[model samples]
Target: MSGASIRAPYDNPMDRHLATTSASPTLVTGAAGFIGFHVVRKLLQRGAAVVGVDNLNAYYDPALKEARLALLRGADGFSFHQIDLSQRDATARLFAETRPETVIHLAAQAGVRYSLTHPESYVDSNLVGFGNVLEGCRHNGTQHLVYASSSSVYGANTHMPFSVHHNVDHPVSLYAATKKANELMAHCYSHLYGLATTGLRFFTVYGPWGRPDMALFKFTRAILAGEPIDVYNNGNMRRDFTYVDDVAEGVVRTAALTASANPAWGGDAPDPATSAAPYRLYNIGNTEPVDLMTMIGVLERALGREAQKRYLPIQPGDVPATWADVDALVQDTGYRPATPLEDGIAAFVAWYRDYYRA
Candidate 1:
């Protein structure tokens, strides 16, 4: 492999050498987001320079995004750019200017139900934005690209403990479809450009600074305000709710260990999780699935209040259960999300109360 061309801030050979010798600075897209924010925090704490980019879209709350950015700004070795990934020209310029060595592409239009009504948003952000990220990595000297995928890709598959090797051709919603499309797009880049890419199929991620639309946050807010919380699937729905920090740790570890072609890969009996190219996929989750009612109970315990529950039928584009099989993640990265639900809830509740003054 040829040496990457160094841009400004690293134009000097000595400076470039020093920067490259240690862990290379990572460009984290969606840096103001939930998982992205945590990933950036972890990367900065590890003494790695982080170039974070976020559009700060008002999909949920821009204020929350700014709050996450504020904390990151205070940290050392952290820089931020408020750029929209969906803009091809701007994204291209960002890559040319930064010439990042590694990229964590976590920006996306993220909600399964929301996708039903807002398909165009998914098309713009997940499809077009992801295309820009891939182009940036390919044109620049990005060594590894770690992007977020979702367990929703296992749509209509009733299998327990969803595995990465299983086929994900069926996606129930545009959100899931876009995530699956990301994996395909990354593979194309890897096969064509030798871009080492890893797609993480995250389960129901919950904790501090999570998206307001997510169950945990909604439940917490409603319960605290003495409002009735919507219990979907008659509270029978289950989720493998992985903690934010654990997900961040796994992402860091995976990023450090760049994807590589599987020597054992054979086209005759191809493994969906790995390829002859430097492309791979893994399921990042807590492995333990908890029912919706159980999660509410945990939240109630954490908040010291009982939730007025309004049980409802399962909604469209929603799955009844989601469980992840993380053996492959464990075998490869030597890591698995192990945060106890109770502990995770407690931490999130603490942060929410403090952040919202509730």
Candidate 2:
């Protein structure tokens, strides 16, 4: 979809069938975010008119977000707006002005641990902000809405590979709860207003420009600085660490393939991932779960330094493991993420070194 080769792994030539082509601009929220930045870059490379919006909050380092924004500023057919979706007036005004054809909504208050400390942030950003986005899409005649959900929605379900078809009523953390709420809210819009919506349940996403709070970034920083790294769950956690590039590709593909009502869907035996209305849910993950220790080892090799790890019990509101069943996504989009831990870690370490001038 861009000058940069999209390396989404699948042997289906029909992938181009879902590719989107429109005169109206594509709206990307959280344009300064890690995944959002990559998505915008890819869309810009494809010569799509894009309007980006972000409050540029201090959730993490604003400078990192600023750096991402700066890269997008150089691209043609790209525009940026500093607006908060939580604010109803501003969000409404933005939609009225731009009136985007397709929307990729990624902005939210992320992190399970942070949600414990700041629960209100989740409600405001995830719930309230998402409601605003849905309204904006509905009122503006937006064709398709691709919003971010999380693998954490699986919560207490000990299922090996989390499936969108599985029930997700028992969310462990507030962050997870809010993401689940986003899906429900999108379904409401899709049902009542005839809006097309797709919810992406992202796995543990990481790569170049990953959030500093994530394990990869923290571990790399501590190891390089000769500091001790916190290894939670006594190094017994597992995650389907999907690379950012692959995740971005999935987002783009999903956005292109607008949600459509499932003719086979019936209330007698409901499928959680799809509905009679134009609403769908798909997990975007690597599908392979790697142990925490294995990830650390990969990082050590990438940085050429062993971490001084302090093993600890699993914290509250944290899961022991998370793996995704992406059969639905592959069936729908003909794409699956295949970035190995070794290669992804190497790329991240290289980027971290260069960006920080380490």
Candidate 3:
């Protein structure tokens, strides 16, 4: 899709709902991370008191995470906690003390490639940490729990524009498996404890203050430094590269509109996205899928430099393509991720040059 096509203004119908709920404190895990930082800022902008939680692990770079936190620290309605959610006691204490009515669980050991080398980290953070979060929300009077799920959950499924209703039984990577597990874990809580939970499967989110391991960040760094960038799958990939701001908007909107049990959901042929319980799943992404080469071309234009690309075989935990079917998200919240890839990349490049003095 062209950049001009997606630069349209967003019209969110959930503005009134968000304004009404903005006074309450919301617990946001991984608040120092890419998506987390953006989400917290959006909440704060809407006059919401945000309790930010992050361990500040060395998954990529602690300096970057800390930098993100510094900006958030200056905000009026923002508070930070440097605690590892994987620690059961620490997590429990956090929930008890904060007593947050709403929770946005975005903390996880992110990165598909990293998960391959350190499977234990994924188990600890994604699985155990998520369990503790579920327990905390279950015990505390958390009215709504909106957590980050990933497009990786649609593993080994060759479906175009992946839908939430698809049965994702086969996850190709451990990271994908853990994400899928989170959805199931959430469903159990929603069914048994009557907790309202909504899972958002985000697709290739990129922008300013993004993760270093992500394509946009790495590519920008390598290109500016005159280094070679490893282009996996021989650049034969298409990603639904949703902008961070768009994703943050969707998350806040979704959180305001709490999940509810689908009355039409029956046992005979159940829908995976919605349940008989107060659980729901939605794909939060740009509906447009851009080619990897096309994305590189855009990045080159933004950076004013050409990347030295080294083509390579598809990685073990990698997918050739990913496209999100965001119809459900629009239908529910009246919000769509319409940020153009060109604009998003340009914004990221500008931030990169400013931050790195490149």
Candidate 4:
């Protein structure tokens, strides 16, 4: 802790520290997707060399993701490669070529409903693909590896404001199971290979350029198209609707720092989210739970039309509510979601109208 060198888990770390503006090349998987696109753009704005990878699969509208990529292509020192995480050979080659010192793993088979229909995609992208990424980091001397986990890991828990210290052993869906598996796998790598890993358990993130599968995006489209927007759980559910910008800020802050084992970490009275190795888990969410009906009302006001709503019971693999307790994230990285749901919804509606020319 004496020298000007940044705190690294290992003595001979491979991280490119800023001795005199020593910025390392960073890799972002799923760079064309909602959260990934925002994180990459923010990194570029901060004068970081960024390499983006996305399979550009037709799971959603590839054209929309392509447009996001198009906007990102003009930046200097920013590169994009169309590759699937499941393709071990191709992913390994890219990692070898980039020689990235830090990686953000965001490319996973997303959506609760989609996982039920196509479970293989979740296994392909979240489990196998994640293992390949770990293998690359282990050999390439990666200093810091940050990956996305989900709040859905708190399945069947009636706990308000889910904390990383709590146990998350039970998962409802294939998607949540894989996300939980990611944390376990990352812990294993950190324990064995000394990889500084941080897993971010994100809540219901929403904002501009959001995913079409999310409730905000789908409700906006349906409301504008003069169709009924489905209100799940009979509009009684609650969610910590975090803004995407806030999420990006948290991700950037977390990436700049490496996880370390707490010196006083206990084994018998263990925290499920941290380890004796250089590994940590954090919950990134708004902390403020907004009711489902309240969110729809905000959308209605933004669109200037009452949504024809069809209320239904909670679907399979859907959680009733989610609230993130971000105390540890704030302590470690000064990270917390700040956007209010009303303002965020309005901003999203504005972006949706302009982006789609509605």
Across residues 1-358, which tens digit of lDDT does each residue of candidate 3 receive? 2223222232454544544554567999999999999998777666667899999999888999999888888677678899998899999999999888899999999889888999999999999999999999988789899999999999999978799989999998999999999999999999999999999999999999999888888888888889999998999999999999999999999998999999999989999999999999999989999999999999999888899999999999999999999989999988899999999998998898899888
- Pairs with steric clashes in candidate 2: none
TM-score of every candidate: 0.94, 0.95, 0.95, 0.94
Superior by lDDT: candidate 1 or candidate 3: 3
Model 2 segments more than 4 A misplaced: 1-20
lDDT of 2 by residue, 160-264 (tens): 789999999999999999999999999999999899999999999999999999999999988999999999999999999999999998998888888999999
Cα lDDT tens digits, model 4, 1-358, are 1112212232112122311134558899999999999998777656567889999999889888988898788676688899988988998898888877889988999988889999999999999999999998988878889999999999878877799998988899889999999999999999999999999999999999899889999999999999999998899899999999999878878887778997777898988878789999999999999899999998899899999989899999999899999999999876668898889999999999999999
Q: How high is the CA lDDT of each candidate model?
A: 0.88, 0.90, 0.90, 0.87
Of 2 and 4, which scores higher on lDDT?
2
Which residue pairs come into collision in candidate 3? Answer: none
* Quality of model 3 by C-alpha lDDT: 0.90
* lDDT (Cα) of model 1: 0.88
Model 3: residues with Cα > 4 Å off, grouped in runs:
1-13, 16-19, 22-24
The worst-scoring run of ten residues by lDDT in candidate 2 lies at: 1-10
Query: How does model 3 score by TM-score?
Result: 0.95
Question: Which sections of candidate 1 miss by over 4 Å?
Answer: 1-24
Please give the distance, in angstroms, between residue 25's alpha carbon in candidate 3 and its true position after superposition.
0.9
